[model samples]
Target: MDWQQILTNVAGEIIAPTTAAYALAAIGLNVHFGMTGLLNFGQAGFMLLGAYGYAIASIAGWPVWAAVLVALACAVVFALILGIPTLKLRGDYLAIVTIAAAEIIRMIGRSTSMTEVTGGNAGLAGDGFKGSFQELSPLPDGNFAIGPWSYSMNLSNSWWVRIVGWALVALACFLVWRWMNSPWGRVLKGIREDEDAVRSLGKNVYAYKMQALVLGGAIGAIAGIVYALPRAVQPDSMGRPMTFYVWTILLLGGAATVFGPVLGSILLWTTLMLVKTVLRDVIPATVLRSEQIEMLGWVLVGVTLMLLVIFRPQGILGDRKELAIDVR
Candidate 1:
């Protein structure tokens, strides 16, 4: 086994655009499941909305700013629509509603009826939409390398995307930190702990929940756009599995903490990359096919999550008292 190559691959994942995208997504989910205690299982719906909105608008001759605005608007509208009636529901009901809504979104995006606009199952081609985002890059046309990793300055999956994506992550973290420390943040924590108690204090629990939903959904939407910058916006690819992965990152990192999502994103991606790379190098193809290795990587991820939950339910940075996992 080429351990050096495997380690380099793992290191590369630490700063990959997809890793940053997942980090941002997990941060958004942290706002929902961590700070607000909302059982939002359909975050993928928000992501899909953002990706589709941005891609569709860009393809229709809009600038990058307008495209992004449209994407954020889609997330806000989706949040309002999803939160209105369902916000009143509790526990399992809310979870079921959210996950179902996400599935509905994916199905609709992939349905033949929306073929012209959404590109159906094929989705919008990355080349068609990525151009606008790439055009905004001010970097000179060249490759830039730091340490053992390098990428184009302006092309797809280039330094520009990494810079912007991680910038967004940093900005999101700062906002979350600010929000988590203010008076509004206290109310959110109260709601997370006990809505009835917060309501007794004359706070509008539903309104607070809706605000949280909209804010988180907007961030999730940005994450979706970031995720799609390098790749095409395929509805199926951004469906339930993406949401689950975001959830896993959040729980793994320690929700309700500022850097937990970022930490979890890095760890999860690096670990997965390392596992898969190692398996491909060490395991003979006669014993396990390429497809089997891919599946085994995920299985290993699941087992690792299980072990983390059993040993440290509050996650790496989460205090048991602030743990969102066992929320009421």
Candidate 2:
């Protein structure tokens, strides 16, 4: 086993754009499930909207700013459409609706009728769309080494994505922290603890829930754009597993905490990559094939999550008292 390679893979994953994208989505989930006590299982739907919206707009000849604005707008509209009909119901209803909605969106992306626009299952590409965006690169076009790892500013540079992804994460965290610290945020916490009590206090519980949904959805949409920018916007990328991964990231970091999502994403990706790499190298091919080794790595992840739930349900950054897994 090449331990050095494993170490590098693990370390690099800590700040990788993929991790950042998950962190972004998890941050939104933290708002819904963690702080606001909303069961939003369709966050992947929001990501899908963002990815396709941006891709479609860019492909249709819209500029970078316009495409981004269109993506965010689509997310807000989606939240409104979902929240208006379901926020008044119980948490379980919202959960069912969200999960179903996410699946529906994915199916739409895969639909043959929409193939010309959405690219069907193959998804859309932003080949010429990112030219303007790349033109604003601050770094010179070349590969630069950072200790053990190296990065480049070529046309396909991930450096741009990393810069944008982490920047968005930081911005989202700052905004969330600010909101959660204010009186409105306190009301959200109250709603999370007991919506009836918040209602008694003359607060419009439904309005608060709707607001949280829209905010979280917008953030999730941004995460989708981040994920899609690396390559094409594939329907499979925003499936149920992606939603579960976002939930895992939130749970791992400590749901409801300001920086929990970011920390959790870094931890989960690093651990997954490291373990997968090591297991592949250490396990003999005769006993278990490479595919089996990959599956085992995921099994290990599931076990780890189960352990966390049993021993420390509050998660790494969560407090025992603040644990509100029940979205009542």
Candidate 3:
């Protein structure tokens, strides 16, 4: 096995734009599940909408800022549509609704009828939308290497994307930290602990829930935009599986903790990259095909996650008390 190459790949994953995108998504989910005890199984829907919104608006001649605003607006609309009628339902019911809603979005995006608008299954080419964002990069154009990693400073998947993606993550972490300590965050915690007690205290529980949903959804949309920065906006890529992955990342890092999502994202991607790289190098192709190797890597990762959940349900930084929820 080329151990140096494996190390390089793993190291690159630590700061990849994809990692930052997942981190942002997990942090958004943290706001919903960890802080407010809301069960949102459709975060992927938020992300998909954001990606589509940005792509469509950009294609329609909107400026970058306008496209971004359109993405956030789409998220807000989706949250309202989901939260208005279902926030009062049981958590499990909400989860079902959310997952279904997300699937609906993916199906719609992939439907042949919407091909002209959304590019259907093919999706919009990244080149069309990424230019606006790339043009905003202040980094000098050249091969910039940090240790084992090197790439264009201003092109797609470049340092500029990494910087912006991680900067958003840092800003998100700071905001979450600040919010969790404020009076509003205290009320969210109260709702998480006991809805009846909070409701009796005259808190507008519904309003707060709606607000949390919108905030988290907007963040998820931002994640989708980030994820699309280096690639096309394929609807299938942000389906139910995406939501599950975000959930896994959130839980792995420690839900309710300020930095749990970021920590979890870093660990999960690096670990996956390391496992895949080592397996590909050490195992011969005749023994295992590339796709099989990929599956095997996920199997190993899944087993590890199962063990972590079995032994430490509270996750790496989460408290058991914070995760306690009365689904009823």
Candidates in order, TM-scores: namely 0.98, 0.96, 0.97
| Model 3: residues with Cα > 4 Å off, grouped in runs | 325-328
Q: In order, what lDDT does every prediction score?
A: 0.92, 0.88, 0.92
Q: Summarize candidate 1's per-residue lDDT along 115-166 as a digit string, tens digits.
A: 9999999999999999888888889999999987889999988999999999
Better of 1 and 2 by lDDT: 1
lDDT, candidate 1, residue 11?
A: 94
- lDDT by residue for model 3 over 51-103, one digit each (tens)? 99998998887888999999999999999999999999867998999999999
Report the Cα lDDT for residue 92, model 1: 86
For lDDT, candidate 2 versus 3, the one ahead is 3
Error of 1 at 327 (Å): 11
- Provide the clash count, candidate 3: 0
TM-score of 2: 0.96
Query: Which rank order by lDDT, best down to worst?
Result: 1, 3, 2
